[model samples]
Target: MAGVFMISDHHFGHKSIIDFESRPFADADEMTETMIDRWNAVVGKDDKVFHLGDFSFLNREKTTAIVSRLNGYKTLILGNHDRGRSRAWWLETGFQEVSEYPIVYGGFFFLSHEPMYMNKHMPYVNIHGHIHGQKYEGNHYFNVCVEHWDYTPVAFEEIVRRVVPSEEQ
Candidate 1:
């Protein structure tokens, strides 16, 4: 079945991220292509993908071309680094939807580029990215950063299973 997936911090065309994140790639070009390959490997042409943030640092033409090469219907939740262009620009670049702020999903999950304050008592889970390589210690927080997920998009069902307590399972 086609699935809903999530991932973040692609940082396409940003060479320094390879060093900053200690990614196992030779350069930005390699990093970008490898991520694209991994993305296409798991995502189908009809899948829906929510990109949490920091999608890319490349110019509009390059970014759009990259998006065209990937599978799935993409949606963007603006990240700190995504401010260089407006929401319309992102939409024009191939993201079907672009959000300026965090959004609620499935009535119980908070989706955002950055982690929101969530606790077990709050009746909500935060599925987010942006603190790559680091994570908040709690069941209510789920980090979808590629750095934490083998540089692949994670299935939404997988995230939901994590939010469901062991006792319930």
Candidate 2:
């Protein structure tokens, strides 16, 4: 089986993210197509992908359609923006979202959309995306949108070794 992966804040139909994020694509369609292509390139049919939040800017139908075209089964940790969309809407898109979760996989904590405030959960690194790669700092954090326009699902091990330091590891 392929390795598990996680990504977030792909604002797929938002043109402003290109400038705001210094994205490589010119527009939302180009961004979406490229993201899908890139995802398919690395992700296999059996690979599970966690999309933390902000999946799209368009309506639920458009968002769902785009998600359906992508590879892997997506588990969504819904963002504040997703609250407007009904639960049925998200379910139809084949993604699961929750307010707070404590799922342990890949030797890391998967808390989507927002990092925890307490340090008591030391070994449990919180993976989240809602700040859009700006003005945020904490322990064991990484942004997928930093060096690329397309989404790159980073493995927790990379984040731990690179950003968190060996002492923390």
Candidate 3:
């Protein structure tokens, strides 16, 4: 089976995201190319990538072009920005699946486009995105946004390391 990965808030083709998020890029093209390269470096053809949301701000053709170049079997957890577009539109861009609601994965993580409320008392961790730079102040809340994760898809093992105490590993 392919490795599982997660990421969010790529904001591709959006020039304002560079300034808004303080991304270190000369331009949108640079950001896009660099992000694609980084993604391809870590993800393989058979890898499964769960993109939590705010994937791109580009039109259909442009978005399709970007998605086609990335390595992975992709799934999108639709975010606020992902709204208004039809599911068919997203699937046409090459995503294997698209979801507007939170998905519980591995029986221990709640994956969502926006951060879900989480506490230590809860049985599962909330792995999410949406807040670009702001920190989620809880051990049970893991932010998978690009800004927090060096603009690359993170491996499931890494998330496990973060959420599982060393003693339990």
How accurate locally is residue 124 in candidate 3, as Cα lDDT from 0 to 100? 78
The parts of candidate 3 lying over 4 Å away from their true place are none
CA lDDT of every candidate: 0.92, 0.68, 0.92
lDDT of 2: 0.68
**What TM-score fits each model?**
0.96, 0.79, 0.96
Clashes of each: 0, 0, 0
lDDT tens digits by residue: candidate 1, 40-125: 99999999999999999998999999999989999999998997789998998899999999888888888999899775689788
lDDT, candidate 3, 1-169, per-residue tens? 7899999999999999999999999999999999999999999999999999999999999999999999999999999999879788999998999987889998888999988877668877888999998877767888999999889999999999988889976
TM-score (C-alpha, index-matched) for candidate 3:
0.96
- In candidate 2, which residue ranges exceed 4 Å CA deviation? 96-108, 135-138, 145-150, 160-169
Where model 1 places Cα greater than 4 Å from the true spot, the runs are 166-169
lDDT by residue (tens digit), candidate 2, 1-169: 5657777788778899899878889788888888888878777888777777777778868887888887776777676667677666777876754433435556666556765454745665666677765634566555544233246676545656655657856
TM-score for candidate 1, please give it: 0.96
RMSD of 3: 1.0
